[model samples]
Target: MRKALAEVGQTYDVVVLGAGAGGMSATVFAALEGMRVLLVERTEYLGGTTAFSAATTWIPLTRHSRAIGADDSREKVSGFLDRAVGNRSPKVLREAFLAAGPEVVETLENKTDVHFRPRPFHPDYLYELEGATSFGRALEPTPFEAGELGADLALIRPPIPEFTILGGMMIDRDDIGHLMKMGKSLKSAVYSARLIGRYYLGKMRHGRDPRLLMGNALIGRMLLTAKKLGVDILTETETTAFVTDKNGVTGVTLRQKGIDKRITVTGGVVLASGGFSRHPKMRTEKLPHPAPEFSPSAPGHTGALHDLAFAAGAHHGTTSAQPCFWAPVSHRRRPDGSMAVFPHFVFDRSKPGIISVGRDGRRFVNESTSYHQFVSAMYATNKDGSHVPTYLIADAKALKTYGMGMIRPGGANIKPYLADGYLTEGATLDELARKLGIDANGLKDSVSRMNAYAKTGVDADFARGTTVYEKANGDPTHGPNPTLGALETAPYYAVKLWPGDIGSAMGLVGDENTRLLREDGSVIEGLYACGNDLQSIMGGVYPGPGITVGPAIVFGAIAARHAAQRAAAARRGEAGQGEAA
Candidate 1:
C-alpha cells in the first residue's frame, strides 16, 4: 500500500491495453469514477477497428429506444442471449456484460458529450426470418465534427468510404424507407435534402473539419467523451508484457522504435489487445483457410496479448481457435493501388460466379446465409483432403459485376483481370463444366433440377429459396427464386474459392465476470482481458449485428470496475496492516 500510493503518476489506478470499443468505454467509466487511468494502444489512433466498424451496436433494447417508446426489456435481452451465446460464456462473464451494457449506453448518453441516437432502421440479422423480431433495438453514433478533437483526432481512424453517411450524398437505410413512403413528392424530397444539407453547413459554420461517415460517427463520438474526461491516450506504443510482483500486476512494458522502457503503474492492467485473427502463424495453423478477406483490424493484430496472458498464467479454454464471422469478398484491384471487394456478391443461377461445389462437385448448404456459415462450410471437407479451391462458375455478368466496383464504369482497370484469364466466360455449360473440372453429367443434373425449382421459387434440395431476406438481398430481377436463377443464358464463368478467415475469436477462457483464469480454473490476480483476446462468449457465431462490440464494451467496463475495486481493497488492507505492525 505504501509502494502503490507512492507510485502516483508513475502508476495509475487502471492501465487499459488497446483503444478499441471495450477499452474506450472501460477507460471512460474508470476515469469518471475518479480512478487514475492510462490507456496504451499500438496504433497511431484510438478506436482500434471500431472507427471503421459497421457502426451498428446490437443490444436488444437500450434506454434511448425505450425512452422513444420501443418495446424492449432486460428480460427479453437475457432470453435472447441465453439462446444465442448460451453456456459458451462463463456465467460471471455473461451476467456482468449483459447487466452493464444498457447502463453504459445510458451513461454515455447523459454524462458525456457523445452523440448516441437509437437506430430505428438497424435490423437484427434474420429479423424477418421466421421467429425473429422486427424492431431492432440498437444505437448508432450521430455524425460528429471530426476536427473538434484537436490533435487527439490524430488518434482516430477514418471509416470506410463506401458506406452511407449523413455528411455525404449516399442514401442510408434510415432514409431509404422514408423516401419510398413519400416517393415522388417534391416537398418530401426537398425536405430530406435540406436535412442532410443542414448537417454539412452546420459543420462548416462551427469551423470543424468533418469525417462524418457512419462508422466514423461512433468513433468521433467516443473520442469526444474520452477527451472531455482527460484520459491519457497513448498510441504508437507497443505493449510487450504485463508486469507483476507476487502480489499482483505492477505495470506494463512499452516499446517505441527499438528502445525499451518500463513504466510502473499501480492500477491493474486491462488487456483489451484484440485477438490473433490477423496473426500470421495463427492464420497458418488454426484458421481453416489460407487467407483473409479485407479485415478492418489494423495490421498490428499479432498474438501478443494472447501469448502475454498465457505467459502470465491465464488458463486456456475450449481448446480451439475459431474463425471470425465474416462475409467472403470477391476482390479485385483498382488503378489507384486500392482493392475493392464486393462482400457476399456471389453469383446466383442467373448471374455468373464460380460454381460452389462440395468435394464431389455437388452443391451443399445455402451459400448465402451469412459469410460465417459460408466459410465454415467451405472447409467442411478439409479433413478428407478433397476440398481445395471451392470453384466459382461464372459467365460474363459475374465478371462485370464481381470485381468492378471502386472503378469507373467501363474503365480500363478491368482489362488486366480479363486479359490474364483470371476470369473465364463460355457459352456452353459443358465447356464451363469441363473448365471447372466437374463431372459434366452431375453438373447438368444439378443445374436442371435447380432450374426447375427456380421456375417455382422453390429449392427442392436444400430449400435455398426460403427467405425474403435472401430474395430482397439477392438479384430481385431474376424472378422466382432470385437466388436460384438459371445459368442457361450462357457466357459461363468460374473462379476457385479459397478457404479464408477474417480473424480469430478464441482465446484465454474466462467466466462471465471477465476474470482471467489459471489452468486449474482458479482466477488469476489483477489480470483481465476483453475484446478478441478473450475467448468469444458467442461461440464464434453471429447472433446480432454488433456482437463483438457491444459485449466488448460491456465486459471491458466490468473488468475495469472490478480491477479498481481490487486495488482499493488492497490499499485499505495495506494501510491497516501497517498500523497493526
Candidate 2:
C-alpha cells in the first residue's frame, strides 16, 4: 500500500529504490519469498521509462517460445549473442542471464499477476549475425484493464503524449494496421470503430481510457502484483544517503515532504534507479563529447544515488562500447510550451521513399538500418558536428503513407507543423534542399542516383534492404524491394533529426547475482543493482528488442533471491549458536 513517509513502517525485509521494471520486479519477487518489502520512487508515479516503452522483452528459451514451436535453443541464442556482443561484457554475466531468463518468466507467471505472450515474428536487430532467428525471443505484455487497478490506477505513469491517440487512448502495434486501413477494409473498419468506441466510453466514465497497452500494460500488471503481495510503495520519496555498518549497507536515509526518515532493511537494498542519463555531471563525464541535447528517458533518472554507491566503494563498468543507447529523434514545441521529443524507431526511416542526409545533402547511412545504428552512423560521420542535426527527407507520397516524426499516418492538416517550422516543405528536391540550407545540386544528384537504385531494386550506395530485420520493418506490399522506392512525388517534406539517448548503458559494476562489486573485485555485501543502475549485460550493443527490460527482470529477481538466501543463512547461524549454548 502507498503511504506517507511518517505512516510507513520503520523496518522492511528488503527496500527497493526506483519503481521501474527492475525495482518493481525485485519488490514483487521478494514479497513472494515471504519478505516485507518497501518500494520507493522519486517521482509521483510508479512506472519510469518502462511505461513509455513498447515493452518488447527479449528472453530466450521460455515456455512462451516453446508453445509457439519456435525453433530455438540455448546453443543458437548463445551463438547469436557471442557474435553480436563478443567480449564487450563478461561471459559469466551472459551465461547467468541466459540460464535464469526462462525461470524468471515462469516464476512470475505461476506466482503473480504478471503475464506475457510471444511475438510471432519479431526479428533480432542483428538478424544477419550467426544463429539469429526471425521469431520467438521477443515477448510482449498481455493487455491489461486499468479498471482492475481501481483507485490506484492514477499512480501508473501515463504514456508519452505523442504516442497516444485522441488525447489519452493507448494503441498497440497490432492496432496500428487496423486503424490505418479502416477506410479501405470492412474488417479493419469494424475493429477501429470498436476500439475508438471503447476508448470514448471509458474516458467519459473514468476521465482517462481504462484499457492499457504496451509498457503501460506491463507496468500495470507488475504494479497490481506488487500491491497484491502487500509491498509498501512510497512515491515522491528521495533517497538522501545509504546507512551502512561494518557489515555493509543496512538501510537508507530518505527525504519525503522535506523531512528526513531512516528505513532499516534486514535483507538488502536493490538499486534500480534508472541510471545516470539525467545527471548533469555524469552525462558530460560518461556520455560522448558533444553530448546529445535531448533524451526520451524519464525525469527521475538523475543518478543521485550513484554518488553514495561510489562513496561506498562501487565502481562503474569498464568494458561498455558506448555509455548510452542511441536513437534519432525529432523535436517540436507543444501548445503548452513543453518540447515534444519523438524517437523515430522502426517507423519512417525503414519505409520506402525516404532517406536521411547530412548537410552536404548526400546520404550518409543506410536508411533501412536499426535506430541505434542509424544514430551511430550520424556520429561516426559527423567529425565537425555537421551531421548532429541531419535531415530526414520524404516525398509527399511517403510522408502521407508512412508518417514523418510526430505526424500520424495519412495526416492531412500540416499547417501547425509548418507554422511552427517543425516541418519544411518544397515543390521540388532542389527547393527542399535550399529551404533546409543544404547543397541543392548535391541533393538533386543524390535523388537521381537513388531513383536509379530504386529502378534496379538495389541500394548500390549503402545496401538498404538486404537484411531480414530491415525488410520486416518495411512495407511488404511494396514490389521488387520492400524498402526501396523512388521519391518522385511532388511537395517533398523533411524533419531535422538529432542523436537522443533512450537510456544509459554504462553503470555500477555488479556480479552475476546482482551484487555490487568494488574495484578490487570484492562483493559489497547487502547491496545490489539492476535495470539501468547495473552496467548493461550487452556492453552497450543493441542486439535485439527488449534487451534492456529482459535483463532488468532477470537480474532483479536474482538480487532478491540472493538477499533472501543471505537472511535465511544468518537466521540458521543464530539458531545453531543457540543450540550449541
Candidate 3:
C-alpha cells in the first residue's frame, strides 16, 4: 500500500531516492531480497523520463536473445563497445554492466512483474561498427493493462501529449504501421478499428487509454511489482540532504507536505534521481556552449540530490564524449499556454523525401542518421549557431506521407499549424527559401543535387541510407534508395529543429558495485548511484537504443544486492558485539 511520509517508519533497510527506472528497480530488487525498501520521488508522478521513452532496453545475450535466435555474445558486444566508445568510460564499469545485465533481466522476470520481449529487427545505431547486430539486442516491454493499477494508475507519469493521438491514445511502432494502412488493407483496418475502439472504451471510463505501451508499460509493470513487494512509496517528497556521519551517508532528511523528517537507512541510500539535465547552474556549467534553450527530459532531474552527493565527496565523470544525450526537437504552444517540446526521434527524418539544411540552404548532416548523431553533427557544423535551428524541409507528398516534426501524418488539417507558425509552408522552393531567410539559389542548387542523387539511388554527400540501421528506419517499400526521394513535389513545408538533450551523460562516478566514489577514488561507504545519477557506462556514446535504460537496470540491481550484503554484514557485526559484551 502507498504510505504518507508521516505513516512511514523511522527507518528502512533501503531508502532509494528517485522513482525513475533505476531507483524503482533498486527498490524492487531490494524488497525481493527480503529487505524493507522505501522509494522516494520528488515529483507526484513516478517513472521520470523513462515514461517518456520508447523503453528499448539494449541488453545483449539474454534468454530473450536465445529465443529470437540472435547470434550475440559478450565478446561481440564488448568489441562493438570498444570500437564505438573507446576508452571514454572505464572498462571495469562496462564489464560489470555486461556481466550483470542478463542476471538482472532473469531475476526481474522470475521475481517481479517486469517483463520484456526482444525486438525482432531493431538495428543498432552504429551498424557499421565491428560487432553491431541487426536484431535481438534491444528488448521492449510488453503492453500492460493500466486498469490493473486501479486508482494508482495516475501515479505513472503520463506520456507526452505529442506522442499520443485522438485525445490520449498511445500507439507504438506496430500500431503506427497498421494505422497507416487502415484503409488500404482489410487486416490492418480490423486491427486499427479494434485498437481505436478499445482506446475509446477505456478512455470513457479512465479519462485516458487503459492500454499502456512502451515506457509506460515498463513503468506500470515495475510499479505493480513494487506494490506487490510492499515497497513503501512516497511521492512529492523532497530529499533536502543526506544525513551523514564519519562512516558516510546513513540517512536522509526529507520534506513532505512542508513537514521535515529524517529517516534512518540500514542498508544504503541509492541515488537515481535522473540527472542534472534540468539544473539551472549545472546546465550552464556542463552543457555545451550556447546551451540549448529547451529540453524534453522529465522535470524531476533538477540535480538537487546531485548537490548533496557532491557535498559528500562524489564527483562527476569527465571523460565522456558529451555531457548530455542530444535529440533534435521542435516546440509548439499548446492550448493551455504551455510549450510542448517534441523530440524528433526516428519519426519523419529517416523517411524518404525529406532533407535538413542550415541557413545557407545546404545539407550538413545525414538526414537518416540516428537522432543523437544528427544533433551532434548539427553542433559540429554550427560554428556560427546557424545550424542550431536547422530546417527540416519536406515536399507535399512527403508531408502527407511521413509527416514532419509535430505535424501528424496524412496532412488532413494543417491550417492550425500554419496559422500558429509551428509549420512554414511554401508553394515553391524559391518561396520557401525566401520565407525561411535562406539563400534561394543555394536551396535550388541543393535540391537539384538531391534530385540527381535520388535518381542514382545513392547519397554521395552523406550516405543517408547505406547502413542497415538507416534502411530499417526508412521506408523499405521505396525503390532505389529507401531513404532517398526527390523533394520535387510543389508546396513544400519546413520545421525548425533545435538541439534538445533528453538526459545527462556526465554524472557521479561509481564503482562496478554501484558505490559512489570520491574524488580520490575512494568509496562513499553507504552511498550508491544508478540511472543517470551514475556516469553513463557507454561513455556518452549512444551505441544503441535503450543504452541508458540498459545500464540503469543492471547497476540498480547491483547496488541493491551490494546493499543487502552490507546490511547482512552489519547485522553479523552487531550480534558479535552483543555476545562479547
Give one digit per residue, the lDDT tens place, for model 1 in 1-581: 00122232466778888877778777877777777777777877667767656556665556766766776666665666666556765555656666777787777778876556765444455443333443445666676656676555555665444433443333445555455455578777876776567657744654333545455666667667777777766667788877877645677787756756676665578888767777677666666554554553455567777777777788545633245655544555546777544445333322323235644556765654555666666666554544455555544554454332232212335556656444544567777677666676776676677657667877777666465444544565666666665546566655555444443567667766577878777776777878777787776766556777777777787787887887677678879999999
Model 1 segments more than 4 A misplaced: 1-9, 64-77, 115-131, 160-209, 289-296, 319-323, 333-361, 382-388, 391-423, 430-446, 465-472, 475-484, 488-490, 493-497, 570-581
Each model's lDDT comes to 0.62, 0.89, 0.90
* lDDT: the better of candidates 1 and 3: 3
Q: Give the runs in model 3 whose Cα sits over 4 Å from its true position.
A: 578-581
lDDT tens string, model 2, 1-581? 89899988888878999988899889888998888899999999988989889888999999999999999999999988988888888888999999999999999999988899997789899988988888899999999987878878888898999999999899987898899889999999999999999999988877787898888888899999988888898999999999988758989998899988999878899999899889999889888767999988688889998888998889898788888888999999888999889999988997888888889988989888888888888888997777989999889999999899998888689989999899999999888988999988878777888888888878999988998998988899996788888899999999999999988789999999999998989988889999999999899899999998999999999999998887667668879999999
Superposed Cα deviation of residue 137, candidate 1 (Å): 4.1
True lDDT of residue 75, candidate 3 = 97
lDDT of the structure predicted as candidate 1: 0.62
Clashes of each: 29, 0, 0
Candidate 3, 119: how far from true, in Å? 1.9
- Model 2 scores a C-alpha lDDT of 0.89
Question: Clashing residue pairs in candidate 3, if any?
Answer: none
**By descending lDDT, how would the candidates be arranged?**
3, 2, 1
